[model samples]
Target: MNPFLIPRRPWTRQCMLPLGARPGLGTAAGNWQRLQEAAGGLPVPGPATLGNQPRLSGDAACCRVTPRLDRPKPLVFSAMWVWALLPILLVLWGTVGFWLVYAMAVANGSVNVTVVFPYISTCGSDPPQSCIFGQVMNVGSFLVVWISYLRFQQVRDWGCPCALNTAGLVLGLLCALGASVVANFQQNNQLETHLFGVFLAFVVGIVYFWVQAALTQQVKPRHGGGWLGPARFCLCATGTALLVAMCALHGLGLKSEAAICEWALTQSLFLLFGLFAEDFRHIESCCVRLQGRAPSPALELGAASTQTLAL
Candidate 1:
C-alpha cells in the first residue's frame, strides 16, 4: 500500500453525512429513512458521469502527484553564458600558444629573422615550442569538436533540415580532426600530412561556417536573424578569400604574405565560431524526459477497485 494513499483516521457516518441531512435523529427508523433519502438524492456513477470525472492521466492529477515549478531557477548561472566562453577560450588558447612559440623561437634563434616570415607551423616546428603547440592544438581541437556539437544540437532543436544540419556537424568534426593532425605532425618532419591538416582546418572549416550561416537564416532566432545570418555569410566569404589569397601568395613565391594570410584566416575562423554566442543567448533551459507506458484497462480497473475498497 502507498503511504500517500492512507487516511489519517477511520471515517464515520456522522462525519460523512450530506449537507441538510440530519445526523442527530433519535429514532432508528427515522435515522434509516433519512440515510436512504440522502443516498437516493446522490448522483449515480453512469458512463456520462465517469466520462466527466478527471482521470489519473489528467493535468490536474499529474500536478497533484508530481510537483513542478513553472520556471525553475538555475543553481549558479545560465549554461548559455558558459557556452559562450568556449569560442573565447579556444581563440585565447591558440593566440597564447602562437605568441609563446614565436617568442621562444626568437630567443633561441631557431627561425631565420630576416629571410622568411615565420608561419604558425614555423614557430611550432622547433623543440620546446613544438611541445606547447601540439598540446595547445590538441586541447583546442577538443574544444572545436565540443562547440561544433553544441551548435549542431542548437540548430537541430530549432527544427533545421536534418540532412543539412548533419552535414554541418560532420564538416565541423572533420575540421577539428584536421587541427589535431596539424598539431601532431610538424611541418619540418611530416610536411605532406601537416598540409592535409591545413586543408581540413581551413578549406573544410570554411564550408562548415557556410552551412551554419544557411542554418542561421533558416532558423531565424527571436533576437534577430537578420543581422547574424548576413554576418556569418560575410565571415565565411572573408575566410574563403583569405584561404585563396594565402594559397595564391604561396604559389607566387610570396611566402611572407602567404604566412600573414594564413594567420589572418585562422583568426577569422575563430571569430566565426564565436558568433554562435548570439544564438546561444536565447537558450534559457534544456530538458530531458523518461516516459513509461500507461496502465492497461484491466490494471486501471483493478487499481480503481482497490482504491474504493481502501476508502
Candidate 2:
C-alpha cells in the first residue's frame, strides 16, 4: 500500500493525501509539494504554516488540504457524566452483595434471621454465599482503587496537593487491601487475619473519609462546594461516631448493637463514595499521549511504525 495516499478513518494519526498523487519521498516537505501539484499549481500551505484559511484553487479546488503542524485533538468518545457511574456501580455492587449473602445464609439455616444479629462477615462465612461475597468484594476493591486514584488526580488538578491528599489516597488503598483480605480469609476460618482486615477496612476507611471531607472543604469546586461538601462532612461524622460506638459496644460484649453499628458504618461509607459523582461530573475526557523523540529517518521514510493508546 502507498504510505501517503491510503484513505484512513477519522481518528487516525497519519494524514491522508489526494488519490493518484505520489510524492518523491515520505517526508513532510515532499507531501506538501505533491499536494500542491494535485491542486494544479496552487500555492497550498506548507507544513510549517499556521492559522492559514483553507483556499480553493484550480482543478482539485474541492479538496482543501491544510498541512500545518498544529497539535492534533484527541478523539473523545464519552461525555463527562460517564465517570459518575463508577461510584454508583460500586454502591450497588456492595449493597446487593451484602443483602444477597445475608438472605442466602438465612435460607440455608446458616444464620438465624431473628435470634442472631450477624455482621457482614458472618453472613458470608458459610458456603455458597461465601463464594459470591468473595467475588463481589474483590471486584469492589478493584473499583475502590480506581476511584482513589481518580480522586487523587482531581484534588491535585484543583491545586490542593497537601499531605492530606496523599494520606487519603494511601488510606483508600489500605482500606481496599483490607476488604480483599477479609474477602479471601473468612472470619470463621481465619479469625485473626479477618479481624485485622476488618480493622483496616472499617477503622482506616473512616479516617480516609474524614481526610477526603477536609480536602473537599479546602479545595472547593468551580461551581462551589454546594451540598457535596456538607454532605461529605456529615457522612464522615456519622461514620466516625458509629465506628467508635461499635468498638465500645463490641468490647462490652454487646454483639447485637455492634453488628448493627457495623452495618450502618458500611452504608455510610458507601454513601460517601457515591457523593464523588459530583466531583467527577466536571471531567470530559482523559487522553494519554506518548512522549518520544521524532521518528527516525527510516521510520519516517516508509518504515511502518504503529502506536496504540488505551483509554
How does each model score on TM-score?
0.67, 0.71
lDDT digits (tens) for residues 139-187 of candidate 2: 9999999999888988888889668899999999999999999999999
The alpha-carbon deviation from the true structure for residue 34 of candidate 1, after best TM-score superposition, in angstroms, is 45
Alpha-carbon error at 223 in model 1, in Å? 3.9
Model 2 misses residue 283 by how many Å?
Answer: 1.3
Which pairs of residues clash in candidate 1, taking residues 3 or more apart in a chain or in different chains?
none
Locate the minimum summed-lDDT window of 10 residues in model 1.
58-67
Report the Cα lDDT for residue 246, model 1.
98
**Model 2, global lDDT:** 0.78
Q: Measured by TM-score, how close is model 1 to the native structure?
A: 0.67
Tens-digit lDDT track for model 1 on 1-311? Answer: 11112122332221122233232333323433443343344322222222333323211110011113244344544575776777788878887777888899888998886888889999999998899989989998999998888888888888889999999999999999999999999999999999999899899999999998888778844454568778889989999999999999999999999999998998899889778777767766555445578789999788655533110
